[model samples]
Target chain A: MRRLRHYARLLAVQMRTSLTLAVQYRFDFFLEGALALFWLAITLIPLLVVYSRRESVAGWSFPEALVVVGWFSVLKSVLDGGVTPSLNFVVEGVRKGTLDFVLLKPADAQFLVSTARFEPWRILDFLGSIAVLVYAFHRLGHAPRAGDLMVGLALFGVALILLYSLWILVVSVSFRVVKVDNLSYLFISIFDAGRWPIDVFKGALRLIFTVVFPLALMTTYPAQALLGKLTSAHALLAGTGGLAFAAIARFVWKRALRAYTSASS
Target chain B: MIRARKLCKTYRVHRRPPGLLEALRSVVRRRYEEVRALCDVSFDIAPGERVGFLGPNGAGKTTALKILSGLLYPTSGSVTVGDFVPQDRRTEFLHMITLVMGQKQQLLWDLPPAETFAMNRALFDLPRDEADATQKELVDLLEIGPLIGKPTRQLSLGERMKCELVAALLHRPRVLFLDEPTIGLDVSMQARVRDFIRRYNESTGATVLLTSHYMEDVAALCPRVIVIDKGHLVYDGDLRTLARRIRPEKRITMHFSSLPAPGELDRLGNCVARSELQATLAVPAAQVTEAVRAALGRLPISDISVEDPPLEEIMQEFLGGQPANGGVRSA
Candidate 1:
């Protein structure tokens, strides 16, 4: 319980630092807010184009696909606001040797580095995603049942863990290959595929999305849970898979730290 | 509080010639060379001792400090700070030590340093009151009260370093690994930092192992120093004893009431520097008293004083004479 409290306090302090930094440049805050809306609008275009000719693509209807896009936007916001900034700080820290400070602290170095920074303005991206999810559900003419909502929220948690674990794997590679900014760009591009429902991907791509990169687990499963179409068994699999990814990420992170020859001071 | 035995750190560096064809060819196959950063280096420091690590650039001083602080693991051998092995980096072990590198900073660039202090308080899990008190004490000591409120980017290099010191020390580390803590600072700023370090050690009984390119920093703050050259530990002992061993001559300066005769100054000792009103001589340690007496008696002298030769000269001569494989000696 004390350890939990300690971590909670650490997270709070990190968030406060991010907030302070976010407000420091008022112009940046406003500009990023505008960009968030712009990106949300851009995200909806392909969905509109595909839905215009056909009533449905694969098995998912337009509103159902919108649900996937909503989740994708939500994850993107978390990636941008919570994960990318912190991990980018880690990469820069590793290059500059400032990661020494993170390592020297008594707390868990991974936790510290993973929460080193945040783009609080990305909360605008998150709110925009909520609006998308709301409009999609409204278009469908019914809200999810409470039980489905609970499952959806739980799956959302699993999705976030998986998303963060994937990023951690990317960051772990950075310890060995110091310059991995392009690797992160590749990751963002791959994540763009998550905007479509899992059914739209078939054969080898479906298998890859389901198991290898797990974009389906990150977006499709939670959307399915909200639509009351997912099974308890699939939910169990998602939970276990998220935990497994986290475990692997932790192992890789530890091994990478052992390999770390901090950049020369 | 700190012990390193036969610490050896080797780095596998990817090497390639500088050419586009070579780069493209190297993509298919790469060459790697093992560079020894530290080899068979050993040292120990008792609690509350201020030991300076002195060496030229790329002399493995920083490498040794990094191993001790647990930022890097030695390729071979063992190191411990306090009761714990550093590479293990146990929470308890990490809580007990801080490494401050002058070339890098831990401060949040866009936020005030007070925010970092708060963040550290949470990260180190210090009680709120205790952390606040420690921050207050350090801020006052560094005289950075007004500056801490400003964004770190707005602060000068010296100011930022002062804040860095406060951040590193706020956890009240038992051992400090300071690498060039006063680097790139003006002379006065350097002296102030050195003074702060000495006082902090005195007050807290913290063990300090510092590496600095500045000889004066080592001279003023460290009673004992470990000198390394070419990845070899050449000497480890009292700073003064090392100085005396390397350059035994004492420097004597005299201000003349009247101009000394042309060769009168040279007769006392080796005249290293001379001007119209004053002259400086390097006299052997054994003959310093005799030389002083001779100068006073034979030459028109207003004032004269004897002091050891400057540390820079001693270090230059010391490192200059050391072979790559010079054996280590401790006084």
Candidate 2:
């Protein structure tokens, strides 16, 4: 509990530092906000062209697809905004040898590296995603009940944690493979698969997305809860899976710290 | 406050020689080389002691420092800073120590150094008042009053180095591992940084282990030095002793009103350098009195001063052309 408080305080200060930095690139701040919308358009335009002729893909209606897009946008924006900057910190810090400073600090090194630099203005992307999600529900002519929305929020929280954990696991590989800074591209590309419904894939590919890579859980699970299509057993299973992935990420990070072999030695 | 016992660090580095073929072949069949960065290197620094860790480039001084600072785990040995094992990196252990690497900075690049200070204050868990006071004191000492508010990217290298020192010292760390803290600074800035380090040590009684290629920095601040060459601890003793051991002769520099004959200084001692108004002669340790007396008595010298040969000269002789003894003296 004491350690938790210490981390909380550390994160508060990090947030302030990040805000100060974000203020420096005021023009870039607006550009990121604009870029978020541009990203959503580019992602949805192709699907719109497909929906013009066909009503749905694999039983997921176009409006339901919008729900998936909503969840996708939220997760992507949050990842690109708050957590992506920090994850890049890990990659850049590892490449630049600057991480030696982070490791020397009293706080948890992983947390410090992730939160050490950011553009908090990207929170605008998060807000925009909420508006998109609401509009999509309006188009579907159905709004989730308060209790179901709460459950969706909880599931979304787990999914967000799971995404961060996965990124941490990827970034942790930097200790052994210092040149793997570009591995973040792999993360985003795989995460792109989450833009579609998991039910569309079949056999081995379906199994991979739902379980191995776990991209579907990052969006589909949360979308299901909002649609009131989620079962208690499936929700519990997804929550357990998220926890297990988080544990693996933590373990990987610990191993990476042991293998750090900081630069300039 | 810091101790290392037979600490060894061996890195398995992937190797590929120049050429596209090697690069392309490496994709399928990579080569690995085991390089011993630190081999049986052992040293102990008592509380409040300032020791200069010296070595030629890639001589394991930095590897040893990383091991001591909890940044790198030694392959097969133990390291402890204060009361905790360094590799364990316990919060108490981390809070009690700091490592400043001159080549890399801790300050947020786009943010003002003040932000980093604020972040460090919380990270180190110092109370607000105490943290602010320490920050003020360090800023004043370094005379970095105006630089703190500006983006760190805009600051000059010298200015950035000063701010870096402030950030590193804000925690009032008990053990400081400084790696090339004064690198690339001007002579005056170098002197100022050296003075600041000395003052900080004096006031807080923090144990400092510093490594710098600038011998002047080590000579001015550290009384003791530990030198490693090719991952071997060749000398660990008083700074003066290392200088005396390697080059015991004193240099006598005289400024003449007029140029002296070329051979005139040869008789007094080995002429290290000669010019119109100034000449430096390296005289044997025992013959310093005789040489000064003879020069004063015979030569038309205007002013003369005697001093030890520069530390760089001693280091050059000690670690000069010979290939590093990859595995020389065993500690």
Mind giving the per-residue lDDT tens digits that candidate 1 earns over B1-331?
Answer: 8888999999999999999999998899999999999999988899999998887778898899889989898999998888999988899998899989999989989888888888888888999899989999999999999998999999999999999999999999989999989877888898899999999999999999888767777888899989888788989999999888878889999999998888888788998998898999999899988998899899999998898887776777888853311222111
The C-alpha lDDT values of all candidates are 0.89, 0.84
For model 1 chain B, the run of ten residues with the poorest summed lDDT: B322-331
lDDT of 2 by residue, A104-218 (tens): 8877777887776666766776777788789889998979988789989999988988898988888889888987756888888888989888888889998888888887777
Measured on C-alpha atoms, candidate 2 has an lDDT of 0.84
Give one digit per residue, the lDDT tens place, for model 2 in B228-281.
988889888998987898898999999887767667788998999978788899
* TM-score of the A-chain for all models: 0.98, 0.95
The prediction achieving the highest DockQ against the true structure is 1
TM-score, chain B only, every model? 0.93, 0.94
Best by lDDT: 1
Question: Cα RMSD (Å) per model?
Answer: 3.2, 3.3
> Which ranges of candidate 1 are over 4 A from the true structure?
B256-259, B274-278, B321-331
**Tens digit of per-residue lDDT, candidate 1, span A1-265:** 9999999998888888888888899998899889988998999999999999999999899999999999899999999889989889988887777788888888888898888889888888999999999999999999999999999999999999999899999999988888888998999899999999989988999999999899989999999999999999989989999999999999999999988889887
Indicate the fraction of true inter-chain contacts that candidate 2 also forms: 0.87
What is model 2's DockQ versus the real complex? 0.76
